[model samples]
Target: MDHGSSHDDEVLGKAFDLRLMRRLVRFLVPYRGLFSVCVLLILVLTGIQSGLPYISKIAIDRFLTLPWAIVTVESAPGSGAPIPLGDDRYLVEISSLSPELRKEWEISGVLSPTRYLFVEEDSDKEGIALEHPDLFAPIAGGYIASESALRSLSPSETLSLRSGAIAGLIRLSILFAIALIVRFVFGVSQVYLLQLTGQKVMYDMRREIFGHVLRLPLSYFDRAPVGRLVTRVTNDVAAINEMFTSMLVNLFRDAFLIFAVMGIMFHLEWRVALVILALFPLIVIAAFEFRRRARAAYREVRRQIARLNAYLQESISGMRIVQLFVQEVKANERFAKINIDKYKASMRQLLTFAVFRPLMSFLSSFAVAIVIWYGGLNVLRGSLSLGALTAFIQYVRMLFEPILELSQGYNILQGAMAAAERIFILLDEPEEDRGGGEAIEEVEGRIEFRNVWFAYNDEEWILKDVSFTVEPGERVAIVGPTGSGKTTIIRLLLRMYPLQKGEILLDGVPIERLDLGFLRSRMAVVLQDVFLFSGDIMDNIRLRAEIPEEEAIEAARFANADFVEDLPDGYRTEVKERGVTLSVGERQLLSFARAVAFKPEILVLDEATASIDSQTESLIQRSLTKIMEDRTSIVIAHRLSTIREADKIIVLHKGKVVEEGTHTELLARGGLYAALHRLQFAELGGGTDPAPPSPSFSEG
Candidate 1:
């Protein structure tokens, strides 16, 4: 099997649709409250995020300018003037004077606040008079003070107003930064929470799907591919993880981002915003078209991959048959065809995404071009400032961002829809017969089939009004040719499939009225094609119960599988996939051991001896007598030697019973039973046996 075929042969087309999405959405019904909380958080985060760029523009326009406030104090050469802080530095004016001497005057005020050094050289704290009249000036109200001013209070007042606006702009920047930090923390928290929740849902869904699959009637498996069903639980569900995470989160995020940006832009200037409005329809139209095509392509890709997987699984399981028949080339050719189909489908899917992604990018670029062209002219005409024009262009870019997001979200939506459809299909399958009433813990294996008729299809009947009965604890052998409904009868007995028209009873109770679980638990079966799990021998035998090592060993011995002890690790010896480490005879013996471990009230053996060599068959024959001593057993066999000592042997031909009696009695009658006996005896070259027929025996 070529592993590369899986990647190369996947299908790509519009196989999933809106209906499947609707079905998947129903799974979230239970988590609506949690989802609502997530949505609200996303909305808040979106609003905060959308305003970030605008806030940046405002900060650039206001605080980015030089200070506009100046406070002037005319203190008659003594009272200081406060110039709004230069950046982070403070400025003080000692008197209204020329800008040239202002720094010297402010230096004195700076030292006065520090320590009042020198105390003006007067040694008196109350007042200090300057020795030099040239350095100090008295106020006009004081004595002979004349003050002339340069750059008067009017200019300072204008600067003060600008400073107020700048302060508010700085505050806005700080607020935006806080919002950004909050959004980041919330985003990480939301992702972690949603991922955990999604994984939990996936785990529960896988278990539910697996249990449902097992409960379905066996006939369902006949129509459905095993590999495809496995994909539904594994790969298909995995594909939806993206939808379960981002799709749920971004549905609110993108919606809020687009609307919030649009609203702010409209408030800024309706004329410039209208350009964005005109391009909105085109962006939406492109998104919808791209989504429709991308979804189809993705669904097709999934379907093809599923088919390829099924083909490979079936091929691997039947590898020996292919080798024995020398059909490797033919098998490879067939596999190559499926692989090619998948490859083509995947390419188509890639192409769909390629086109869709670029188209979105182009639409977003077109919106940006419209803003630059229109807003640039408004700025030139003095209708809008350069800063405002820059901000409007950014808003246009924001409008197209969500279109890209929604496009990606569409892909997630489609994958989830496909997975949901497969899950729903499995959930809808019919369940196996569970019986209408409670099951009996103790059952007398006196089973009777009264006028049973059935067919897998409506065209022909496989079992034609079949009727038979076996006494309790009787070792009855049902002998028939291939396609004579021998296996069909056993399947119905297990309730693996419902009988079309019949009543099978254990003791005097109808089998249909018994609980299915109890009935299967009490009835053990060993078939020709036995399935083995990948585990130790002990694990295989004590499948449902944690039996002790001693008990497991004892059960293995009773089934004559003590050869397991000679292996490298004995009972703990690991079995490879499908029990590949053991030969067919060894695997069959383990199956027998498992059946015996269950201690079933009734054991059904269907071709259990067919795969073993003569020596192994003889070993089983010895164990059979003791194993079936107290338990009722139904043995469907073709080997005459195995059934020679059965308490009763029923011969069937073409769904009709031809003869029934003790082995010797049937031989004496020389009917279909005698002919089968002769065929076996002649083939084995066993000339004759001394066993005699009862003188007076009844046959029907």
Candidate 2:
């Protein structure tokens, strides 16, 4: 009931429709191994990425936090000896010393000899002496001090401490480097594997959709515009490809990343992780809204693009008519209107993305601010280490990246869903019925239309009670004015459309009961308008059939297509789109050659030579007679002169058979056929006679 372009009316569907997703997943079934590899790589990559921040935390807490100072130690009297504490430091036991001696040691900046600590002092007084200066002396260069004492290290001790600190820093740096390299490797591998899997899946989907389009009923195409179908097969399929190659795998990757970051944050500090989690609902809301608007916008974009394409295809195809009628300005105006519609749709999609991306970024930044504020307080309160707080900040930032990416991926998913809906709709269309009847390897060319009535649309009959029969090997010419159901009869015989009220028999077997391919293979029909694909002449003749090159050439010769040999490439001569480089007569000859190559048992010509000039018509007529010989031929012609040699003639007018007989007998009857003949002859500047001799008349 809608009357809008079918492409425009295509439903957008839900972004995550389960039924549609299930259908999409079926495409990945054959590539499960690749998909498995990509999943494994994503998991590994996420793990490595999550661990890097923890490694930084370790460097901050362990090695970097160690104190930087030098200590002085004294051997306890004679019984006390210095004990090694490893790494160029020593300890002494002073518990055995007398209290007076301990007091003396304490006054001299020394603890019990066993546990001496470093103390800081003025560099200018490095050599200054005191009453107990001899008692407290730095071990490496000057005096000994207590464990609790603060002393500046002598030059030698300073060098040793600096060297140790540098070594620890180097070790941490090496660990960081290792983590960085490992993460890089896994990241690259993950991306490559995921993209490869997506590409392969896309390839499979495109192939399957194209194959399905080829098998749809011809009647479906009769109503569907070429441009809309092209969009379905090409542009719509590409949108789905973008989803596969970018969105689908990235969806999993981003989810893994977000969860991994959350887990790490919680492990470091649950309270800080909760701060980030509190923002998740907001992000989810934004994502949902983005998906909704984006899906609608993208659907509009697709619809507009379909409209633009259809207009362009129509305009370019009918350019000659437009120019001849001086409608160039009007045509341009129409094109500009369609083009602007598409442009507006595209900009809407752009604006949606532009707004959503930054909005996501803003949410992510707000979450990060929350983490920094809360986590910073915990670090300052001494409840959380500075390193842990820093890691939390990093994790929070990483968390939002995936959220933002998830939002963008959702955008891709929405577009892909719209595309998938259209594609699946096409795939769901019923294929042409191949029929369950017995197959026929061969058939006598006998055709009969028994009281057949048909309409392309609801009771608006194109043919009413049309009945006729042609025996085996009989040449029957159907003469009619335009729209008299002559061509419709030919279409019905070829089973291009279903019969509504009658049966068509081929060789005494109803065509509805014949194998579609076998039935079609037995007959060849050439239309008044010739269509040629962009290929060499030989390919056009052979089509999908495996006719040998020599045999194709022989068929061409039989059809009097000798002009092909005169072309630069001979049989290999390139035919541009629609065979534009060839003359009208040449295209007709090629069609004849195609029919001849197929070697059909029945031939149907629907005014095949109606458009050619007088000279070209003569050439085609000679080849037509050759191809029709010994073959049961049914010719629909406006030019009565062309059908004069037929064994029988059936005259049609207003969807009914007005008369039937051979040419002379039909002329003698002075019915529709005679009137048409007289009109055609008079147009050629000849006078009509009641009884004329058998003269060679040129066809219009």
Candidate 3:
């Protein structure tokens, strides 16, 4: 299979895809209670936010300024007295007051009083005009007086008014403070809940995606780079996390804030509200333009970063080859190009945001200017109160804030949608096929391959019409030059890949008709390249398979890996990444011990001893006989000496089996095996005389 060229770098979809949204909502179902609480907090926080400006307006109009008060007086029979207006000012009719009372009134605080024709005494003629006409105006007969202009209040009345005004101011201040404190508390709670919910959802999504990636077939990994998958599980999921924590919750808050501001504005003055409404189309247009450009920029950024990461991973992994070939300059040039491309994409995204943010701010300022100009006119004409106009301006500013936030939120939403699309695409990949067949508790270790034909791609067969069989407890060896499908045979036997055109059977039952897990569990394979995970030596041997410590030690002893006991920590020695601290031969020996620990019925060794030293080879050869004592074994060998004593040997060339027999029989036949054996003998500086049998040269 070709191990290159991933096709996952597709452009993102729309910023608000319904299908994607529906799927995303499924993850929230399990945490609906937390989600609901967060939403409730959003609404409560919005209400508190909206009420603050209204409270300010009330404080301005009600407590900060004094309001006019009017007083009325009536005369009683036999009680002709003056009524006090303020500061001992009296309102006495000319006909009702006696001379004594009038003298008393003249001594009062009223200095110069204004008098008007109480009522026209003569029907056709006007009465004498008032001298202080500016202070008092005639209204419905008896002269009306303005205490604020003509008199001062008594000390008691003055104190009462001052006290009331102060009380009103204190009340308004308390309400304002309460609003602020409540808003702060609720805002904090809302943010905390939102982040908590977002984190939980992110955890679930990452878990599901990681699990799905693990279950995918090996073929998928051949083409998909590890970096890209890492991005999907880590970076891509984080983008969605930003959406849930910031965008999703704030979306509702912004909308509610805008609506609440609009409602208050319209209630205060619909005409002023209409002016603000006219600017909506402009904001909407700008938002749409921003969304379009931002989505493209973000999608390009994601793609570029993926490429950058893939290149870095490949370069780092192959750095050895790169340095060996003295191609560091070329490698750096390639990496630099990818890095520059990513920077350019990121800059484009930055530019998009930079333009939109300031543009929205300018538009918001423009809306505030319109409110001030138009509302200020109505306030001058006394049609709108000064406090109401002030509140309208505040509301207009509040309205645009959410709009600006919404535009930015759209950028986040676009990024999230892009991430979700990629994540879902990966989650949608098909898992390895778990065949619907009978599961077996045990197998007798008899294996057969019938008319096998296989290929990684198309009909360029790697294994062509190959047939072979090995009876129970038999040892078989497959010998072939490179590209002769020897390794493919072992892979097929383990059912790593599906058969394109043939049947493999275990104990007279077709392998494909056996449970995948159960069939694989019955055999153990030791590959040439030993992969050691970063862990202790004991864990590597047992692979967390619940093997008893004693069994593990015995397996190590059986494989002749006594070197493990000589380490400082023995089986507990720490293995670094890829087991770099251990030699290749040591790693291979650990693999042998791992295979023995599993204690399978069939053992398949594929070039297992190609890297061992002579001394280690001697120990491995002795262990091999013990390992294959009562088991069916298939040994794919490169060194002729390793498989000379095999019960049967199959020779293959160019995807076809050319011969099958014991080593001496094949050597006598003088076919491909004999030719290969003779070449090895020549390399060893020995003539065509059979070398004496030795345990060091046994099958590995």
Candidate 4:
């Protein structure tokens, strides 16, 4: 098929790989005792389950022998009928034989349904063919009192070989009880074990996947979709749970039961059992072929489901954007196309299942029919007993159960395997590149990006040999047109992605040498889009920072966010979904305050005031200058007025530094920077000097 279909098959194929399955079994290694106990219990239960029908046959044979001449072969004088042996009747009997007829009977056999009960002594005295017959008299009497009285004949007067028949009813009742109890105990135990294992394993799987996802590089997430990853962590792992909990266990139990029952059948009569087993190869071949097709179909189904889940998630998350752009109809049509594809995949899988299950059922039924035909004739020819024939029928039916269970198990395994492939692919992704350098003991906040080249993909370079430097405790504004790789510089400097050609340095040390966590801890960034957690104002501001409450309020005041005091609950005030409860200006101010509360050595702002009104913008600028004092700062400025007082302004055009100087120096240069200034801020008609701009600084 196509690449996507092939990928699905690869995933589904993982379930059947002996090596992979063995590794997966390692998860149960800690609970080996429980697993061993469970396996032993299942085997015991399966054997017991299979043997019950044979026991029923013994009971039936005993009952049949109770009221007939167990042996009669000699002709009577006048009636021309066979003479019953011994003085007693109603017991299984042996008879004297003619030379020729007896030889034939000895060599082959003659068995019929005619009732012929004779009596014989328990000459062997082993007492296997006899019992006292008094112990169960009361029980038998309740059912047939007259028959019981006759059956309890005294040994001194006359004893019968069929004495075992007297307790036939009791024997059958005991066997049934034991069988039912075994079944009940095994069923309950299996459920408890399966559920317990499933729940524990599922919890661990989710935790592991989520933990790995968290440690992955941010660039990995930039390329991956949110919903697809969610599908793996949720739906894919859930599929594995379903298989492990139920399907895999049942497959083992059923297969074991079927084989054990077959062994017993062969023990009784290998010739007849072989005839019954002759049909198995055909069944297996058919099942294997069908399973292959079903697996392919189911893998397609899983792929469709993932695509659909991703589509649905994206559609809902961006519903407002879709509506604003009037693309609802287009989105709906796209959804419909994917939904139809999913439906088709499911139907194809269903079709495969529909064919496979019934085919297996039919093959099993045919095997049973063959057994009945041959087994019934064997009974007629005296090669088999009626009870044995009944047992064979039971055994034949039992064989089908495993086949059926295997079919279902294969279905689940195939689906799970497909899901697992996708999940494993994610888990196999390479982690962030921590360059082989010793960790930095400390950082001084002096920063430089020297001849760095980078790209998100191999197709085009987003940044090309771009270089810049900022002195310690200096504020620099990075101004550029949209898509000119302004954000990329910060990303590279932070080592979210490795630089292609050159290195970024901090405090005279290559950033690669620094501990990633320590580097991030010393730096703070507030993006154009403010992300507020689902908590009160104070919690969001602290955000695992653990700042003192008093310091938090002071920082808020510095970011012009003291508006919390005018609200009903100050810093404790709740922010609803994504901080919708707060105005955009308020959210931006809080983000700034959060940054200040961290007391970072360096601060970075990406058009943090881009969306706020000019009035709020003016208030934030005053707070911004106060926060920038004595700190190394990088401001990606969209509003020219906001960065007028920066110590240095670096104008970027298409990933290259086109100009660098104070605002006035850039205006005097009359280059690309001058053109951008005229286009962006000239309409304001502001003077060159804005309250004595911050003194410009340079790279050492």
TM-score of each: 0.79, 0.82, 0.83, 0.83
Candidate-wise lDDT, in order: 0.69, 0.75, 0.76, 0.72
lDDT of candidate 2 over 1-700, digit per residue (tens) = 2213554435666667778878988988988898788788778777777888887786665444433222244432433444444454445433344445444444454432133332225443343322246435545433445423323445554444335446876887898798788878877887787778777877787888889888888788888776667777777777777887778777877888888888878776678788788888998899889878887887788678767666776778889999999999998988788788889999999999899888987887787788788988765543455577778878877887777777677656777887888788889999998775666657888899999999999999989999889998899998777778887888888888998998999888889889888888899889877889888888999997578988999999999998998899998888887788888888999999999999999999987867766667667888988999999999876545558889999988889888999988988898887887776676555443221322312131
Consecutive 10-residue window with the lowest summed lDDT within model 4: 691-700
| Tens-digit lDDT track of model 1 for 308-425 | 7767877888999999999899999998998998999899989888887787778777877877888777655434444566778787777777778877787776556656766777
- The reply for model 4, stretches above 4 Å from the true place, is 1-15, 64-107, 110-166, 433-443, 565-570, 686-700
Cα lDDT tens digits for candidate 4, 1-700: 1213223333445457665566557666766676676777778778778878877777765575334322333433122234333333122222233334433442343323443333234344324224543322222112111234444555543344444565676778887897889789887896787677777777777887898888888899887766568877888788888877777778778878877988988865566899978887888888788877877887778678767766776778788999999999998898899899999999998998888778877887887788788888776665556777888888888887788678768777866766666777787887665554455555568999888888888747888888889998999998877778888888887789877788888887888887787777789999878999887898888887568898988889888889988999888888889988778888899999999999999999887767777567777878888889999999987665656778899888777888899988988999877777666545556534232211111100
Cα RMSD, each candidate: 11.1, 8.6, 10.0, 7.7
Which should have the higher lDDT, number 1 or number 2? Answer: 2
Model 3 lDDT tens row, 474-588: 9999987777888889888877788899899899888878877777778999988898888899999999658998999999999887799999999999998788888877888
Query: Model 3 reaches what TM-score against the true structure?
Result: 0.83
How far off is residue 93 in model 1, in Å?
25
Candidate achieving higher lDDT, 2 or 4: 2
| TM-score comparison, 1 vs 3, better candidate | 3
Which candidate gets the maximum lDDT versus the true structure? 3
Q: Rank order by lDDT, top first?
A: 3, 2, 4, 1
User: What is the Cα-based TM-score of model 1?
Assistant: 0.79
Stretches of model 3 off by over 4 angstroms after superposition: 1-10, 69-162, 678-681, 686-700
